[model samples]
Target: MEAAIAVLVAQFKAFAGADGSTDTLSKGEFQNLVTSQLPNLVKNSADPAVIEQLMSSLDQNDDGELTFLEFWQLVGRLANQHGGFSR
Candidate 1:
């Protein structure tokens, strides 16, 4: 769980910038960031079906990008679902 969170944080940092800040990512930037970073988890997802569903469900803002809160929420949700973490 920690590892997963760490990986996500690192990816967010990379997308946001060398300063490792989430505040720097714009809406579009966040979308691109997720598109590039979440390949492994999202690759086998459904068509316009799963991707669209996830984008709408997870993106939160509908800005076509994910904020830090959204990112963390998704991670926490997955962790819970997979028994990767408790509380």
Candidate 2:
């Protein structure tokens, strides 16, 4: 469990800087993160429209970028679906 958390943090940090900021993910960064790291979980992730909609849905603050907390929403949702978060 600790390792999984570390991986998630590492991945977020890895892609959060693609556009400039080290604290958040730009739209392109989020898209890259999802498509590359979450291919099986995020269907049609390569599509711009799909990425736009996902960004809209997850960017709760309307800040145009996703902070770690915003990014975690997707992770938590997926984990819940697979029973990884309900133990």
Candidate 3:
């Protein structure tokens, strides 16, 4: 569990820092992260419009960027869906 969380943090940091911002992921960063790292988990990753809609849905603050928390929402949802967690 600890290792999994660490990997998640590291992955986020790796992408978040690509554009010199470790605090949030810009649209392009998010798209890259999803397409490269979550190819099997995220559907329609090849579609820019789908990625745009996903980013919009997860950008809770409407800041046009995704903070760690916002990004975590995607992680949590995917985990739930993959793990078949009831709730």
Candidate 4:
């Protein structure tokens, strides 16, 4: 469990805010992370429209970026669905 959390955090930091901020994920970063890291969970992740729509839905504050909380929530949902963690 601890390892999982660490890995997530590391990956988040690795992909967050290419312009320098380590606290949030820009749309491009989010798209890259999803398509590259979560290929099985996110089908057609390379599709810009799909990523944009998904990002729009996840951007709760409509800030055009995702904080770790938002990104974590999306991962949790996808994990439940794709990784069968819900079961």
Most lDDT-accurate candidate? 3
For model 1, the stretches where C-alpha displacement exceeds 4 angstroms are 1-4, 15-43, 46-48, 84-87
* TM agreement with the true structure for every prediction: 0.53, 0.89, 0.94, 0.91
Residue 80, model 3: lDDT of: 91
Our tally of clashes for model 1 stands at 0
Query: Order of candidates by lDDT, top first?
Result: 3, 4, 2, 1
Clashes of 2: 0
Residue 23 displacement in candidate 4 (angstroms): 0.4
Could you give candidate 3's per-residue lDDT for residues 34-58 as a string of tens digits? 9999999999997999899999999
How does residue 64 of candidate 2 score in lDDT?
Answer: 94
Model 2 vs. true fold: TM:
0.89
TM-score of 3: 0.94
- Backbone clash pairs for candidate 3 read none
Model 4 lDDT per residue over 11-74, tens place: 9999995769989999999999999999988889999999999999899999999999989888
**Candidate 1 on 25-78: residue-level lDDT in tens?**
554455566566665555544345555566567776677656678767766666
lDDT of candidate 4 at residue 35, scale 0 to 100? 92
